[model samples]
Target: MCNKHLMVVLIILAFDLAVATDSGLETTQAGGGLENRPQRDVSCRNHQEYPHDNICCLSCPAGSYVKSACTSAHERGTCENCDFDTYTEHDNGLLQCLKCTKCRPDQEIVARCTNTQNTECQCKAGRFCAPDQACEICKKCTICKDDEVKVRNCTTISNTECKRQLSTSSNKSGAVAAVLVLIAGSTVIVAFLKRKKKFVGEQDSQNPSEMEKVVVDSGSGLSDEEMQNKLNGRLYDSPLLEQAQAVGQQALANKEKETKQGNSFTSTAHSSPASLPTLPSAPLPAPYPHPRPVSPSHPNTRDDDLPRKKLVPLNGDKSLTDCFSYFEEVDVHFHNRFFRRIGLNDNAIKNRENLQPEDRVHQLLNVWLEKVGMEASINDLIAALLHLNQRLSAENIIAKAISEGHFEYEGKQPRDESQL
Candidate 1:
């Protein structure tokens, strides 16, 4: 009964201590009630690593720190700096309302300071900080992490875009691009072929109107035999005949060229003939194969007295030159090829006297007449002939479109009234 009474008395004392708070709110009672203002203060003189101004307890600044209790109600000295992450702009009296730290420029915001003691922080949507972190500052988000793909771009606000290491559009675009390429290529090829054919035709065609005026007079039609005979007779005095003569004379020169070729080939074959097995006597390489010689015309049918000369100088050989029908020849050889095809048919054919593209070739005749060395005009028959001939000789040219006939000059034909 006496022990029970002691317990009740103890309960009453505990109740009284818990209430009637005048002991400056309250204090941890160690030995007695209302003990001399709790003399043992937490010493913070040595704890100075962070919050330089804040130690055990003191007032933190306004716009900066938080109230985490004071070291004493009486002057316990000024507050030290807040926790490393916490801030106090200036004097905050006894209350230390801390300032929230901003994330660094390269980082994003995590948790904002709040009313509760358990403040939560998180990296902005795409960012993250490692564990054991207060997250006073957050870091930038990771770019594409998948190794197979790479980050193509990272916009200021948008998420980082990942691109395939290889080209993704290749498969689909390849076919379409191929088709477009084929069309373009085919167009180019067709144009090229047409140009080539036109060129060949220019080179080979005989513009009949150039050399001979089509005197569609009140004339009569001649027989085929007469025409054939006339043609055959004309062949005796043709440019072909002149060329043949030149060739015959140049045979020795041609032979020399062949000899030169053989010599060069032999020399080229042996970088150093030391590589060859040395015999007691050396042997020469074989010469290039020569074309088989053609037989001369049958004696009975041959021209018994055709003039022949090694050097037929073209100075004033009226006989050799007059043999060329200059007036008729240029007309027959150039007009149809160059002028007519280029949309100047009627006028170009009619004005078949001069071959002049523009300036240079036009003045060649003058140059030749004056014995001047240079050709002034590029429009002349020879120049046009050269240009067209080069085009015709290309790898992909047509011959038929360029050529009209091998000038087997049949003498004459009467024009029908219907032709007019």
Candidate 2:
């Protein structure tokens, strides 16, 4: 029995040993199968550095063209020189050399084509490309207009530039216009002055005795009122003055009769023919007040006693309105002279030609206030205007209006005295 147990244990040990040896052999065979598996070759170089047909080949050198492919590894292709107008900038494996670019009609070759570079183009002297980037064709340069001038001449890379011809032409035209206006104005003024002088000479010749009498009376000791009355009586034979004198005499007689009646009422009444009444001598009527000259030291005082003349609307159909209307009625040249005397600037004077009558009046008033340093009364302003007219010509409506006191008031009742 002991022998039998020992033999059984030995047989079991041999079976376990056999199983371990078989597992080790199977693992070795599996590892050897994995080691024998095939892998694809991944060492093929890029075509740009090493081109290939059946094997890899070297690239062509710079400044050369590839004419044929290599048949073996580590070898270059058949290389050749580029044609005259052709180029090859890099080691390209191309079958043919590149053709050079041709310049357009408006372009010129800046750099000629060579083995290593292409041609470069630029615009000609008088032409330029419309779009500068990679431009295929060039366009003609811009031409300046008649009223324009060239600022920059055209170049290979840039277009022509221009600027307007305004400064010289505008300034010259304005100066010429101003000069012509001044010359024409001066000519008109000279002619007007000569005509006025001739008229004055004729008037003096016709009224020599009257002028001499005035000179004689001025030296006399007569008061201004008496002198004026005497002058008026000698100068005019109008019925208005005579009628005014008769009315004054009638008023004086009525006052005297009232005074005599009052004395009789106060004293005892007597009914005798010789003691009844005595007629008071009628007093002479006072002369109408003459316009006072404007005193330089007291300009405001000139219009204090004068009646205020009512202003008429500029659009009114009445013969007279403001002083500006009188200026317009005279002549355009006379009006311009008046504006100059009032110290209006050139712009304002020029603008006056286009203004309406009312606008002109306001403008004149403003200018007068600025120059005279004071507000102008209607009478004083009109008197100054009339005075200006007298300086220009002898046949002045304003002067006659002032002398005859025709411009007293705008409404019905005319005043007796002439102001300013």
Those runs of model 2 whose alpha carbons end farther than 4 Å from true positions after fitting are 1-50, 54-56, 130-136, 146-152, 163-420
- Model 1 misplaced regions, further than 4 Å: 1-58, 63-159, 163-174, 208-420
Q: Could you tell me the C-alpha RMSD of candidate 1 in Å? A: 31.4
**For candidate 2, lDDT tens digit of each residue in 253-331?**
8677757788664353344445534432434445445533444344343233334455332333232333344454544
**Which candidate wins on lDDT?**
2
Error of 2 at 121 (Å): 2.7
Q: Rate the local accuracy (lDDT) of all candidates.
A: 0.39, 0.56
Clashing pairs in 2: none
RMSD of 2: 28.9
Residues 1-420 of candidate 1 have per-residue lDDT tens digits of 999999999999998776655433434567665443422333443322122232354334433343354444323344445554455444444345444555555554445644222234445554555556565555454354333354543332444456546656876697787787677667656765675555446436532111111111121233343344334444433443344444444654655665777866557647756543222121222221331112235222222122211112233333222322222333334435544322343543433233333322233333333442342221232233333332222111112111322121113233122211
